[model samples]
Target: MSATRRQILSGAGASVAGIAFTGALSELFAGSASAASGVRAPGDRPPRGGYGPLVPDPRGLLDLPAGFRYKVLSRQGDPLRSGEGPVPSNHDGMGAFPGHRGRVHLVRNHENKTTGKLGVPTVPGLTYDPAAKGGCTVLELDGRNHVLGERVAVAGTAVNCAGGPTPWNTWLTCEETEDKAGTNGYAKDHGFVFEVDGADPRRTGAVPLTALGRFQHEAVAVDPRSGIVYETEDAFDRPFGLFYRFLPRKPLGGTGSLRAGGALEAMRVPGVPDLSAVRETGTRFEGVEWVPVPDPLAAETPIRFQDFGPKGITHAQKLEGCYWGGRAVYFVSSFARTGDGSAATHFGQVWKYEPHRRRLTLVVVFGPSTDIRLPGESPDNICLAPTGGLMVSEDGGGAQHVFGVSERGEVYPVARGRQNIGTPEEPEWGEFAGVTFSPDRSTMYVNCYTPGTTFAVTGPWHR
Candidate 1:
């Protein structure tokens, strides 16, 4: 979802092409009449008393809110152990542990989006690579970006996308392939989450969370209170896809095994019974509710809440990048179809899910009408900054950047990607895919999936 697209430039519901100047303004400022009738638009930004870039060139260096610095913790091909092997490439998703004395455990998801060459053959014990088999890596890092200890070879997983950190200090590595085992040496069953622990490698209890129905798994977020895990899908078939939640069979106490079966459910905008009915208008949709998990676990979930659909119905669009931020769950769609009938839809949006209040609200939408210089920038993995905002990863190529979006609707780039990430001829690190802060929120750990490198960024990010 890039801002340069003319479709998203039109604003809320109307197309910006060849319209009256005043009409264009209204379209951008106009609130959705069908959903939350009188609610204010989420695109408003407050005047900043003080704000500026903290680093000289935020590209390689980490951009903190304020008073922060970063260090190169580790790079790909770095030696982990005596006989293990060099660090693999395409380090996608990562996690950091605070209690481990600054030791960070990361599950690097290899893209294989390009040519395979994953880095398994390099390791002696590791022997798997259909489209590339380099799953998760547990690396221990200090505050100064020093590698304390590391263990590689997650064993039997490929195309590992983004994963979520569990309440029990373990990383849940998810295989993003829709194909099951047998097709390739990847996960015997695709679309599953594997539990990996840093302290105990010999413990050997890693199991695939089959209960959490197999699909194009993107990311998972677990609720510490009930151990209920929220999930996202990356499917592109038919009426788009859905956002799901997995409730573990037992309570999440002390965090042991995540294999226990539980209830799995998908999200529904309630009143919008037929998703097909929603016209392909790129208006920012809001006021959605959760639906049941469905018996077959393949769409068809019963509606639970209905208020924002039907008459003025609109699709939730591509719901990707979700995380537990503040007291609520925050989710964002990659891009919505432009009402202007263009192949590109640059209006990317973010929403907040409040379980206690049982209400869903649109927090922000970016496009030609908004503050983001580039609309339609697909925001990948997201996390809430300690200063209380969202740290988003931009996977889009041209405007590739890591954004620190303030709660007041201010969007600023914290880092940028060098044109070409990695290649023998032109190797350049680019973009932070996953960003997480220490419990204290004083330090931030960022990773460049393009170059497959991770850095420890320490600074005063909180204004």
Candidate 2:
């Protein structure tokens, strides 16, 4: 069925009945439950198959529930305005911004770092480090979430993975890998967060947010009230991964402010000392403190192995997605146990951070990763839902999916992915990324990795 404004407007009042987002933080607070609505808060156990059973898609592209449907917004090899080799592959993270004149802009990341011809070429002054690949592209969409035009926003970076949208209407794309300067043909030191305006791609700065610290950066979420940036590291090296907070010298500076420098600290439990966060689900920890990292940019040593390491700084395994939630920041630790102070389990873990209270809680966990029948596992990217919940993109071993969690933590398949079998050795079982909503909440945008496809999904979400 064709998605229309009427279909969404007719159900908006009814779906938002049980949930309400108010205050200046409405945009950042994706889906936080209200007690009056009879919805449970974070750290609560979710019911199995909460949304509904997945109804297979006849077209074998994606599976959705009865009323929900999706439309392919962009596909791999789609020619861009710059003709940049049909949009480089490995579409990782993305941000959807409100465009001028009712249009929507999507700043997408091409997770490219190869020496091949797939990366976006340099655009004179707009390029960061022309010697390196892996940058972002901007897509303009109409009111109905249809693609209008797309062009390279910023090129000349490395491993342009997931990032969060700033309150000032800019996109912060983070490089997942930390390839130093002059090494592996890299012209400059990689592993830094660069800001790009979705509206004007040419204005993207050529410098990185050095104050934000350099490690295997994955994703970030900024608290608008305080402008405190909460970051997650995907470093699988010796010291493992750690949750971080960037205390900028000035708040509300908006974009291009982090380059001035700031205090980067690691999240830690005050009295308990060393914490690996390798426990069961529903685990809660209070008195969380921020320990200063001796060095933000560690060339020889990993950032997590600095003075904070011996001080018993807390750490997790493969910290991937980070999102600003109700009075807190929720992050995900994608699978990794046994050797990193965690127990042997294939499932992933979700954690919540309360900035005001300085507390961290293990809200949701996907256990027994060996079980292929579970609702969700190894959640990679996450975003707020209009239903006052969360939508997570699964990057696990089994069939990929975009899982939806309710206010009470109910897990169900909101969308199922189909593997495009092109080569006998490889079936392109796409992993979903960039699960964000439109400015008006009429549509939810997501992406798949394998074939690099972006989709706009809409339906009776609350129902």
Candidate 3:
């Protein structure tokens, strides 16, 4: 039996209600609660039968399942409709929204720094820092996934990495660097979340949302109900990064509401100081609490180093993707290796946090794997599939792929990267980022981090 598009979009199995699996796939995830933690051995391969198997693209760009195909919506050097020089390089995190006249609007981030191959053109009003090269660009696509136009949404931010969409139809583009002013010729201290209005680029003021805290931010997820913004820090130093939540002063007031100011706090799980130490899946942390970051702006010290009492704030290595689904916030730790100073080693881990219940659960954990092609390794930029599971963009070594993980812990490959930007002797495949679906769930949009390409993929999504 073929799965419907709606079923494929919202079919999260047991992790999400109203979806059930049968036969082999069901048995793959049909273990005891403890046994269903989604942990695999180092050499264990991911379960197959996702969309059959990926067929290499004749164009040698992206490989998808037999019936699926992709179209290049935008490229690094492509001309923009707004007459802005060109689409900037290093396309990173992105958000897709319902566009005017049944179209789709995408706000894409360029992970450029002070110096890069091509910087986001610093338009007069859209630019925040003249010396910064990282920002966001807005792209409009028609029903057929044709690019209607592309323009700068926000600019002049440094190291724009991965961010999340807002409940108010905006995109939060984050800076993944803690570089301060006077460093790298920066005019102002970098590292803040900036809101981009995908529907109307003019509404994006290029103003930094300072209250959200200044740190090495990876991504954010806004709770549609409470309007609280959950942020992840991607610092990979000795201190690591903290999971943060911003209590917006104005709840769900739409764009620019975050600027009204709110409390920035770090998450603390009583006895757990570092998330990397927890190697087991399905590990539950009860009564999780948030502690105020005395210095969110990091005027004297970074938020992670700020005093959070005797227990101290919890920290994690490589805190990356974040999204809100099933009334909880889902976040990712891309990978934790002992050589990277982590207490434990793992390919990846997905965590779910229940706000009302103050409970945190490890939903999916990828065990150590030497194989770089392992589907679940280094899962980044995750989104809730309309069909019922989670889609993860791979950022680890080896051939890159966008992976799908069912709610019951069934893993499958959705798409693979076949583009080799490097020479044949040293083939290099860019990491996948910004794996998001359109409002209609008919298209899946993703980014190739290098040579910077944005693709709109559509096919038999329900298979």
Candidate 4:
């Protein structure tokens, strides 16, 4: 459930105003929906809950409501005009932007880590590591399923994780692996953030923004008003993961260039220690402070174990998706329950950070799940619907569905995904990721990581 208005800001669970945050679109939607019907295609199961409960997909690919429809825009093994062999698998985070005329530009992440597939190998001189199999692909599309063009936006990165959309209109693609230089073959360090131009993919040379520090970066959110960048770590080993903020020496410049010479710092709560240990759903921590990382590069040590660890920055479990909304940086922690090795009680927690107040508060959270058909367990990628509150892409086991959490703490289903049979003996059930809407808000786009597929959805989104 949601916290009181005051609780969302202050650490106290009190309500000051009955209001909805700018980023949460729950207010515009209805609480419960009349179960809808579906027509199953060959080898597909009946539909479950979604926008209108879900209608079975006749194509056996995706399920939607009565009026809604979906089209597979891009798929794995699809030939690209760009030299990047074929569309890579393990598609993760993504962002969409306005392009020429009525076209929209999309920069999608391919999270594959092995060198088996042809990663982002299209660019001539821009290849970072020819042997690495993780990078991003750029696509230009129109209102329908037509893919105007596609190409490699960047390459040579490992575990290219979820990044944020810069105010300067570039996608900051972060590498999730932490392989040292020359260790995993012959190449430079792995974990770094690279900026790719969405307006024109070919122009972006896949330059790494080293000033943001290197670690297991899960996601990033840039505060538009302050030009400060907030990052999340997905570390699982010793020293756990910590939240970070990178202050550019100079404010954000043109072309999405993250200026070097900036200081990276970890987040901490003054007196309320251990933000992760909080057991309640709306637990809040006010007056959050920033501790310098001293060596953000982490060449000698990971970001969590650095001096910043002893300084009292709160440690979290697998911090994932991050985004800017309602004057706060909304972030996600997959699971932190007692079973998750954390003292916390929730299976997942969503946090909100106020840049002006330098405060961090827990916003949305979920307990363990029993049914696989519902929005099970882990909540990964995040999206802000102007009229639908917060839509979360569930990365949980069993049924992979996109669930919505309202500002008032109410949770509901947005969509559900069905497994597409490809290779036998392998679980084709993929996470619904890289969720974003068209600039016009008429179409919604999402991806299934394996049996790699990208779908464009459109209908009465107001529901």
Candidate 5:
């Protein structure tokens, strides 16, 4: 899952660029009462202090604010409660759902390719392709953040990257590869989203939702009101990737609804061909339209490469994290550099799309910075804070951190990665992923990508 590392260029200090707006847009910038209930909207300036300075951890695994502490919930190679072999590696995107007896269910993705320390157990009925090695695991935890049980939810999928949770309490685990059945001993074509039922493993069939389009999927956001599924493609190639929306035939229908099929379309901004070309913050693109994907399965060519008439679909570099907040669907462009064939370069960008108005707004743009500790570059997996804000997991160079951006736009570190599973002579800090809060928001759960580990963090969230 590692891409070619690009040179870090020095530039003006980091800045969270934004412009003022009134009415609904203003409410969107602030915490919208109608926005996905507890989720906070993105877009604001960065003020200094947040919870407070992060205190170094005594265990040397994580660094958090003064009042915060974390517990290791699960680690790679650990025995599973189901006795289905050991845990898999490369823990990535995850979703938290309400479980029975006041328990919280977490469905986590294992971004494993053809190889890993231990593949997700291909338990007979739950396996999609025996040759594949990437899937999801469901972890049950009580209110106190104590693990109740953990088991395999889905198995046999490959390159399971980041996916979003549905309104019906299931998780959409996306495959982040375009490998075909004949390649690398794969028995089936990969790169499709699979629905995993965290509450009941039996309900998850491990079937791929092919209508959602086959590509290098990064993440998805579903509109609670419309049931429209918005998807992001993370292809790092020359043509880059296109933002997509899957209009399910069975919108809002629970579980197997996505299997009924839907139209997969790419988003277009008329004159804007590449989103990376947009430099200024608050750059609004009105009258946005959706173009039907010529081939959702991409049997012969990728969706982004397929011709979309003279207008063509809009593309962006490193389209990563995505989630529904209030009335808008927020997505991230991790970063763009000149060496990557992007029209322009920037450290990071967060975009807000309003379906009702057919408007796309650039809410937050991170200016270039040389500091590796800064939380402005390569922002990945994100979730709405229960206390009204957004928590972004950093996947950039140097030390990684889980950052909190309040509705007022105050950027602060929520936690930092200090774990070095590698040798002491060649230390490595794995990028943080799956930054999500429990249903009650009492505990925050995140994952370390390398030497995979899950953490349950508790602290004075209100403070």
Candidate 6:
């Protein structure tokens, strides 16, 4: 559903104001008991209906495609180094760091915009914060799930949500907060993208892509060739949400650091004034297109794209997860609500934006269908599977389930029983968040934030 001012206001009570976010950081913690929330009792595991035999459900561990299985690469409180503390709560976005001896450097975003649960310091130069919630956590891990090292307190901000991997192997962590520096001290730099080195988590730097402007940031996508970074926001109120692109000032001579700033531009629908009217209308298979990034650095300039009014803006609502795959960029809306903030017939949707042709395709409208029984449930984070399918984490209810759908539109269950992570009251669990696959496509990782837990899933899937 489109998060209204009422929603934001309701959460305002939890919003932490100035007080040096770092100071909020405190003792390190470990994953809560009960494995993962929303998970089913052991024996009821769905058989390998599509992928393979009915292997034992990982339970608290990562769930994967039927034929596939996984192992726990890391847990919430696991020590990355000898004396380092556990990772923080609310792990979000991450990316793979490249090198001959490549490893996955995960820059996890904490959705905790208020509470402070930062970890302990292992070395002399470590920065310890008792109030480091809502920032990003850096963890280095090998494919075998071996912990190489970790760095907490990366960017001292809150609600840092879904970010993307840049061409340079850096993870761009986006803050979902609106620009309210007047109150949220970090809001000035909070709504912009912060770059963190994937190789070294200890090395934390906060540089707002001023060119990227400020808004309720969601996710970021990069075009390796042009060095242009595309971004999505969760704004559902004013003028609707926008799709943006950051035109860097300089190209990396050899995949340099994100320290090289660039121009940020918001996208608007061409010829459409208010996209609010066309929220959920089904697609006509018409060729989709987006308006140009006018100011290139201004957040206000309109960058429009074609949408449906009969159904309301399909891309409307609190836009969340995003990924760059198959020569195109894909994004999903958290929920489709009316201007009055009422739930649409469907809970969520997935859309595709072809950068080369500058077009959009409303690929899927999720609801109560023959296959997916969950209607009015919102689909959260998504990742592309090597087997040419899309992996989605369902955040609708506390009992979360993961699913896979091939390019041909065939959908099936990959993993089940991921619920129970969050208590009914806390809001944020339900087994759907941070769904990703290993580079080799042999492993899968899932994280449920409310009562934080990380699962490593492995199985057989021909990528």
Clashes of each: 19, 1, 11, 8, 2, 47
Q: How close is candidate 2 to the true structure, as a TM-score?
A: 0.84
Model 3 TM-score?
Answer: 0.88
Q: Give me the displacement of residue 298 in model 4, in angstroms.
A: 1.0
Please provide, for model 6 over 223-332, each residue's C-alpha lDDT reduced to its tens digit, 9 standing for 90 to 100: 76677777787874644576666677885533344446665554444544333334443442344443344443334432333233332332356678876654566676
Best by lDDT: 5
Which pairs clash in the backbone of model 5?
A: 35-326, 36-326
| lDDT, candidates in the order shown | 0.54, 0.72, 0.79, 0.69, 0.80, 0.53
Task: Return the TM-score for each candidate structure.
Answer: 0.73, 0.84, 0.88, 0.84, 0.90, 0.73
Error of 2 at 258 (Å): 2.3
The top-ranked prediction according to TM-score is: 5
Tens digits of per-residue lDDT for model 1, 292-343: 4434223333112223234322334455777665356666666656463323
Show the lowest summed lDDT stretch of 10 residues, model 5: 4-13
Question: Candidate 6: lDDT of 18?
Answer: 13
Worst 10 residues of 3 by lDDT: 14-23
Write candidate 3's Cα lDDT for 1-463 as tens digits: 1123223322222121122212122222222122233443342332234565667678888887667889999899988889978889998998999977889899999999988678999898899998999999989999999888889898899899989889788999999998999999999998999999987876867899999999999999999899999999999696889999999899899888898999999999999988988866568999999988898899988777788898877889999988776467888888887898888887777788889999998866663232222455566777766455567776655567777766455556677777897789977788888888888777899999987999999986644
TM-score: the better of candidates 3 and 4? 3
lDDT tens digits, residue span 419-455, model 2: 5645556554667787888876667788888788888
Report the candidate with higher TM-score, 2 versus 6: 2
lDDT leaderboard ranking: 5, 3, 2, 4, 1, 6
Residues 260-352, model 4: lDDT tens digits:
558888888776444567655456666788888878788798877766554566788878988776457777887765564665555566777
Model 4 weakest 10-residue run by lDDT: 31-40
Deviation of model 1 at 62, angstroms:
6.9
